[model samples]
Target: MNTTRTLIAAAIATVGTAAHAVDLKAGEWDIAIGGIVNAYYTHTSCSGSQAVGGAALATKGLGCGGTDGRTVIGNGLLPNALTTTAKTRQEGLDISATLMIGAAVASGDAISNNNNNVDVRQGFVTFGNADMGTVKLGRDYGLFGSSAILGDMTLLGAGAPVAATQRNRVTLGHIGSGYTYLGTYGQIAYSLPTSGGFSATVALMSPVDAGTAIGRNEPQLQALATARFGGGKAWLGVKRQKFEGTGGAASFTMNAAEVGASFSAGALGFAANVQSGKGLGVLTDGDSGNRKQTNVLLQATWQATAKTKFGLNWGESRLKDGAATDLRSNTNVTAGLYYGLTRSVTLVAELSRTTSKPVTGEQARMNGFALGGIVFF
Candidate 1:
């Protein structure tokens, strides 16, 4: 697969259950395991008779028998996922290992690649404590862009289009819709001792080899630092990689940087961030591997009642090009509601609209609404 395909696969699997590992004491290993299953009823409509990529179709939604609209039982932002963790103490130090897997939900042939075949999302081990700091080694999410995802309100439902046809009905939380996803990788990460609400993270990651690009022999550095105080927190992250092309193609380099801030008081919360870089991979996950891009995100939420919350968010992802005729930007707007049905079940509803505009000034639009619930075990 190419970089775009690799990135799409990664982003498509973003809807994860993230069950709190259930602890089952088994000898020296405290085996904790759990999983979650989520699905949604989606109704999407298009302004024109074409699907995302100009594919000719009926007037109704994919399954609705018309090209202008489609309706199907879809997977929301959270997919069926399972997580297991084992922890113990050694030499007066704490140690632990975790394994997380997830897949899409559907009957489509492609769903097998995205859903039925479980993919390992997290496989890592950590060692150490407060005084000794901490060390982590394995495959997991890159430190960059994680904070932005953590604050996104789309965790409970679908926010962005994962597929052009939209039959799968599942997608990553606001990725490419409200922000960009940071590709996961294998790395050795270390956390410095915290001081006065300040902490730092540093990792040496295996060079990215998504698609046909070659992995650099040297490790890439990923760094992040944050400060938390009172009702707000701020963070910054940076990463750099040099890619060797396959098939004797030209080699290239990528550099990425992102900064974000979050605040909360009483029943109100807010977050904002901006990221920019060249060859850092957005939309294509470095497929082109040389496109310059920038993203800006803004969001806010209100806990209106003990069991109800309301939120609205907006974001824009822009690609800088040498020629004005090339692709320029994709913008999104979203509003949603979350209501607790019970401690273990939550009801979710969301509406979103996205527009893609090229330098030629033409625009293509897509709008979607998702209704779903998250059931925790």
Candidate 2:
């Protein structure tokens, strides 16, 4: 049998076997495992200097570049010091395992891999009940860290949002191959009982030391609230991060807020979001100038058929000199189509274009296209 068919059959058999085993259990203990495989090919074109080292650096003009500005696409697959290519070929597997012990102790881990290489995505334990809400300890999703409208669902390829755009400011920044370290973070989330087609969720998060950064005596806190009404949903979230006692040489704080909404009717869905933040540093002169940043996004999806879907996304980000005026900006547009080959497999193709304003005497533009497939089991 083909790989897709084999995986689907194995999943079905495993679930069936697990269900039978659970029926013989005396107490509440449950376990489940699942995974997804994604692969894609990408091509890209670029102009001017790309953003580098949190600052836009000079590029030797426009050309087709791989993942790390390597002249050869194969060389870009690995890490490099210069510009990181916005698009490249990649394949990976995301696996998740969950365990529940009675009604109080619950734990899970989500891991991803490029080929056989492992990357930890989530590892956390939870304690609580329906009436008391839940408290999660360890590394997990941060409060206000992700959007409810389209959680982690990116279309195939070159059109995918950059790592920064998809990141949750309430958590540590993403690094290396688009992975975010959960760090030492804890979360408390509560959902109110539904009434009249309305439901709400409020969450809070605190930082933990995951050893990613040492001697970093800083704390971060976040709050997020979301409400759903009929076919529409809205959310507001805020985060405050402080880095203290680095001998006043390099310490900074970031404050961010975001608002978003989404609506769905029939087979069509629409969503929009806006986020703003300021990064400030303390110096001998008392709080040197701050950097202001804003991001906005709009997206739409249509389930054209039982086996086909279409999507469009547009986003823009601007950075300024603390007055909320745009000093430099980046904008991107993407459109794509997906076709389901089976209940567990899909094929996708997409195109994307991005443009950036003048930064350090240069302008940058990039365009790319991609095609790929994904299988879930």
Candidate 3:
């Protein structure tokens, strides 16, 4: 009986040791993979030129037979011809994915990755903790590139005019259309620990060169601070970029700054943002000339029920004189509503209208509407 009891105790100890060894050396990593699939039907109403039979066709020329006068071909294929009409139609899907990995780091050292082939969604490695803040490096969001009130909800496609513009501002570090800006360069950010519901972050990013002439441009710097008081939150931010070359033979610099606030009460939220800056051509209009601009956006959101929310937004941008007027000034208004279909799925419908007046005596207006569903995993 004594030998049997001793054998059992020894076996238990051996098993415990093996479990500890596995826990220490195996599966010590954490991985998270997520994706969003947004399928939408879009309709637009705008008067624009269309193509017919591989040739530019006037708006009135649409629906006409090709210049070759050939209409029917085998399998509905254009026999040496094609045709297009300026008809509003519906379109398909927009999908994106993201993967994140994190691991324990030793003091003074951090985890890093090549980030190759990864979509421009997000990629970064942070070391340290709240006490000492943290050092983050890799492709990531730029400081001051987004307003706090808007940044928090960018994933849902709502934000300030500047924030929305930043998504397509190529020379300003935005990756491009249909992709999130990863900033493909180095970034250093420090996030102060939350204190009394207030926090701040300051970050700097290396300049992204668009060409040889712009290769030597100075680095981009941004500073953002946010404070929450009562039921309202206010934020202030600044961003600067120095173009490398002389503009119109005049050597100068470009800068931009923004301030915004948001307040909430019960089921309603109100937010407003304003930005004024110089040399924003890096993102708007894309001219190397010096220019000053201001943009403002106001939004309101209401939660009518636990599963539904509605939003309205209005935005406008104006370019100061001495700037090219081809792009002119524009105003946009968007209204949207979303309903939660499930824990991981949502249905959204939105309508947007834009009006522009160009300095070249051209006036245009566009209206677009989209209905979509987003599935997350």
Candidate 4:
């Protein structure tokens, strides 16, 4: 349920000389087909006597629920996607359409007869030229927090898994710890043509309830600006939304801002991102009480060899407003090794430790390991 401007390319790296897409020409239209398929065997172990359920982890019941550890075979952060694009030029206009379907490998664990779910993550169309920018309609990636998720190295593999029993959903890859998932949404958006490695985008997206009881009468506003220089890229993004309380809750407004940058030197790459806002849920979006929260993610990667890579990252999300018993912070650290087994396939292994701390209580901890392979074409 998440995507960035570079979601496709970033999720499925163009490895070696293997073609990431297949192009065909039919009359006046050009068509391309591409996709990624991945699966992982994940094991998680948890400790600490304190129940870290809803009190300390905002995405409670996810990852680990206590001393019980679970194992699963499932999709990673980025699900299996089959995407197709068709483009053509007509009447001095650049027109294109995209449709992507995502699938999962795991089925309901406890269900006697159940199948995995498929997500129509992206179904959008665009029309415009370089001189006039582009207008996008339908569902696509949101503007806010786009850079943060793209900057995360775990996008290629699983970083954390939800409850051991939950198999149908994709694993959590630093989602609640590093940054809130900027889920895909139906929207009408515009992108200013790129110039000098700089570009901008703005969108009005569908409203989300975000586990809160509120009335959303208007669309959410999201915008982003990005700049690239040399081996570095930086971005700034903001989002705003209005909420009217339903029942007895109080009315509130949600506002958030984020800044992120990534730099590469030699075989080493680094990334950092920070987001802070009011009414932004610690793990997701809106909050009924309009709490303040901040999240930070830092990453480093090394290209060990022509076909081998190593990476390490740490991230945390903290809530500034909470009672003594309320959740406080969720943090995670992960190390990974990725090897290119073939032109279009990669072998991945990752280890991660997650910790959740409350305002006043013993913290909870979980350690996880994931082994997987992903292929692209």
Top candidate (TM-score): 4
List model 1 lDDT by residue over 1-377, tens digit each. 01111222232222222234467887777887766667777666656323222111112332132445565565676566676778888887778887777776654565355544566667888887778778889987777777676667776767753333334435655666445676568989998877788888889888867467777697888888888889888999888888888886767777879999999888888999888888766543464457788878899889888778898888887777735444466677779898777655668898887666555544556677778877665
Worst 10 residues of 2 by lDDT: 76-85
List where candidate 4 sits over 4 angstroms from the true fold.
Answer: 1-6, 14-19, 53-60, 65-67, 110-116, 164-166, 287-289
Q: TM-score of each candidate?
A: 0.85, 0.64, 0.65, 0.93
lDDT of each residue in 1-377, candidate 3, tens digit only: 01001111222221121111111111433333333333344433433322211101111121112121111111000001111111111232111112232221111112332112122423555554446654555555455535422222223432211211111120111111111122234666666766776777777777654322242546677677778888787888776666565343544455777788888799887888777777554232124245566666677778788778788876666556632234345565767777777665666676665455443444444454555554443
Q: Which segments of candidate 1 are over 4 A away from where they belong? A: 1-21, 48-68, 109-115, 165-169, 210-212, 247-249, 322-325
In order, candidate lDDTs are 0.67, 0.42, 0.43, 0.78
Q: Per model, state how many residue pairs clash.
A: 13, 2, 1, 0
lDDT of 4: 0.78
Off by over 4 Å in 2: 1-27, 49-117, 148-158, 161-218, 245-250, 280-290, 322-327
Better of 2 and 4 by lDDT: 4
Q: Candidate 3 clashing pairs?
A: 53-82
The alpha-carbon deviation from the true structure for residue 329 of candidate 4, after best TM-score superposition, in angstroms, is: 0.5
